[model samples]
Target chain A: MHTRTIEILVGLFLIAGVVAALALAINVSGLTGSNNGSYKVYAHFENIGGLTKKAEVTLAGVQIGTVTQISIDADLLVAKVEMEIFSEVNYLSIDSSVQILTAGLLGGKYIGLSVGAEDEVLVEGSIIEDSQSALVLEELIGKFLFDKVSE
Target chain B: MNISNKIMDGIASMGRGLLDNLAGLGRASMVLVHALFVWPQPKTSFSLVVKQLYNVGVKSLLIIVVSGLFIGMVLGLQGYTILVDFGSEQSVGQMVALSLVRELAPVVTALLFAGRAGSALTAEIGLMKATEQLASLEMIGVDPLRRIVAPRLWAGFISMPILSMIFAIVGVYGGALVSIEWLGVFSGSYWSVMQGAVDFYDDILNGVIKAVVFGFAITWIAVYQGLESVPTSEGISQSTTRTVVYSSLIILALDFVLTALMFGDV
Candidate 1:
């Protein structure tokens, strides 16, 4: 009876290990899949300090895709962001504008897109127009403090 | 001599003792590595390594799994509560995953394994020494360090990585289940949060390295204490206690060093 009990325990442990392994593999695959042939769009930002790779790009606060890569263009001195938008959200028009947004007053940065009602849909490699740069928290705080000093 | 002179003399003596111990430790480590490579015949030790892996890694799975689940759940609950105050419940997945992958899973699982298996190893080896089995092996020209200690060391190192991987996965699952299933977190946002939270190679490699270091410490301390045991039963018991205490301390110290080295400015 004791031997059987030990065997059962060992079996349960093995199952747990297998389940855990599968979960991790699934999560990893999910991340990799997020970078597939999902269409890319570029947004220029003056500052994107808290903005990171894989940060969600949301339409109406609903995630349409994620920021894949970010690089500063030396000539423009602007941060150019590459995003992967899902095929389902391909209805975004070429006149659509992108904004770097925050969840709240002290929240991580995300991309916000304002949909334009133009008949034309955005091409895969098009740049988002009417873009707003990231709202730097420290600069905003400094501005607020500076206003108080001047007043 | 004056009191100040006596104090200086004592300080000088302590410094010499520290240097002497360090030299001895350096030589001993070199010998241990040499013995590990040369003494164990691959033909015979292959099966031994497999058995030890099963005993060390597979055997401790349950405790690690259960502990990991609870740890994840706790992290989710606490993180949700704090994040919700700021109305950011969606970020709970990222917070939970980051904590589990980077810190909690590896350290907690290693400590748990050390408490369980490390104690058992110390006692088993101490008892064998008390019974003079080690001496008998020595008389027969059997290198006990290679045969017994090496297997335990290898077992511990392998077990730690396996257990850590288990812990990280289970913890993430537990967090996801609690937040998404129990609470009303959106499936879309939960996944989005997790995407930013985990890096495949970075997190896994960190966990594996921490586990390997932990395993080495546990087994090394256990075997060192066991080998130093006297024939008396009391001495054996004392050795076992010292082994567990020292191993636990070393594990914590090494965890800090490894974390700093792996992820700077921790």
Candidate 2:
């Protein structure tokens, strides 16, 4: 091939490679726009049960936000989970319930939200009052065995 | 000869071999430092780098794409089978994507590059040496290191990360083809879950770093072997083989260290 043609092809190749890297970053890894236009809300749980930061915060089986931080509330002796809810989801009632739930049988943990009937709406820095801690399978099994022995 | 004399001779030869290997390593490091640190004339080197990029990067695209696709398809098929037992077939996407982006793309691409471009580089420069072209260039006031070696080295450095990214992107889609099309995996979950699982900084960027490092090491070894060859046909063949072998070993070793540093908790 001609030198000019080769140079053009090489240029195209580089552009394509860069485009691929961008796709991997944006499309595959979901790198951008993750926390944009989002408001923070806190929920306290007795046990988080392997719930990690960046885990999905879903409502009605659709993701609405992500878990931003998980920390221990020393005063309450509970897990204080911080979530970034999208600005579009600004209608969550103050009394809305959040539960730490697992996906599938052996999948990741996420926070599931159920809207409540209330006039007040949750805003930034609002604490979600109604929260259910994640179920520890080992505890449940242990309780079941103890009940069996008692019986 | 007595047994003691034979034992001493064996130990002396082994020590000599080790010393020779160490000297070779030191020389190779010097060549790499010179090639990288000493900037060539930018006016003419642009075209040289472009030419080398065409030869190294564009020529190697076919094998990378084909291998990436096949490897991803196989991963999908195998991952599905294993995950099906756990009733987590939807995770096949994550499995394939994570493996390809984090490990397979960089590692496998480097191995293939060592075999394909690395050996070719060794042989080409070895031939140039054998034909006294490099020597003739030196006599004519042209620095062969600046004109030839530097361009090829830069080409290799630039090509590797690009090639690895292409390999990963192609592989992910190939995996999707098999999992979503063939195995009846839900397409939405396959992609969404993968996106959720793969971290841009931890996985993709780290993988790119690995690719760049591998590129530098492989190209450095190739050119060094070529320049140091005995300037004969037999010597050229030996150097080519050594280039491939050494590149592969170094890639694997460096990969382990990089992975530990990038991914390990420690």
Candidate 3:
């Protein structure tokens, strides 16, 4: 090839490579670039189990938000989860409930939200009133064995 | 010689060898520092860098893409077999994507770069030295390090991360092809789960960072070996071999350190 053609090819290669990197960042890795479309909501559970920050916060079966932070409510002795719900999902009633649920038999934990029937919808910084802690298998097994022994 | 005398001689030779290796390392590091810090003339350097990029990056693209595809497909197949037993066959996408983005793409691309481009660099520079071209350039008041080594080094450094990213992107698609198309996996869940699981900053960015580090080390080793080789055909061959061997070992060792620092819990 001519020197000019080779140089152009090289230039194209570099450009394509850079574009691929950007694609990986944006498309595959899901870099959304901003949090302006989301509002914060809080929920507290007695035990979160393996639920982690950034875990899916699903309404019905669709993901509507993510767990932004998890901390202890020192006074209440509960695990406080801060979620960023999409602003479009503004219909969650103040009485909406959240439950920690597993994806599969052996999968990550997520918070499933069940909307409530009420006139007052939850707003930014609203604390979900009804919440269920994650299921602990060992505790369930222990209870079952104890019940059987007692019987 | 007596037993003690022989033992003392062996100890003395071992110390001498250690000192020689340390001195060589110091020299190699100096070569890297100089190549990095010294600025070559831009008007000419840009063209030089482009040419070297073509030689190193463009030439190596086919191997990178092919290997990436096969590796991803293999991961998909293996992950499906394992996760299927657990009744989470849909997670094959997540497994393939995570493995490629977090570890395989960068590491494998770097290893291939060392073998394909790094050895070639060593041999090319060694040949130039053998033919007295470097010395001739020096005699003409040209800085050979700035003119020759710096551009090649920069080209290698730039090419590696780009190659690795392409590898990862292609690999993800390859995995998708196997899982969603051929294996009867739900396409939506396959992609959605992968997107949910792989974080840009934690997984993709860290992988890119690993690629960048590997590039810098591999190029530095290749150029240093070339520059330090004896000016003979056999010496050039030896330097090329050393470039591949040393680069591979350094890449693996540095990968462990980088992974620990980047991903390990304190």
Best by TM-score: 2
Per-residue alpha-carbon lDDT of candidate 1 for residues B57-124, written as tens digits (9 for 90 to 100): 77787798899999988887888888888888988888888888778877888788877888778778
CAPRI-wise, candidate 1 is acceptable
Better of 2 and 3 by TM-score: 2
- Residue B109, model 1, lDDT: 84
Q: Report, for candidate 1, the interface RMSD.
A: 3.8
Candidate 3 clashing pairs, residues 3+ apart or interchain: none
Q: Report the TM-score of chain B alone for all candidates.
A: 0.87, 0.96, 0.97
- Weakest lDDT window of 10 consecutive positions for candidate 2 chain A: A27-36
Give the lDDT ranking, best first: 2, 3, 1
Deviation (Å) of B34 in candidate 3: 3.1
DockQ-best of 1 and 3: 3
Which of the two candidates, 2 or 3, achieves a greater DockQ against the reference? 2
User: In model 2, which runs have C-alpha deviations exceeding 4 angstroms?
Assistant: A141-151, B1-16
Query: Candidate 3 lDDT, tens digit per residue, A1-151?
Result: 6889889889888897988888887667767778899999999999999998767899887889889899999999999999999999988899999999998798778999999889899899999989999999998999999999999
Candidate 1 true-interface contact recovery: 0.21
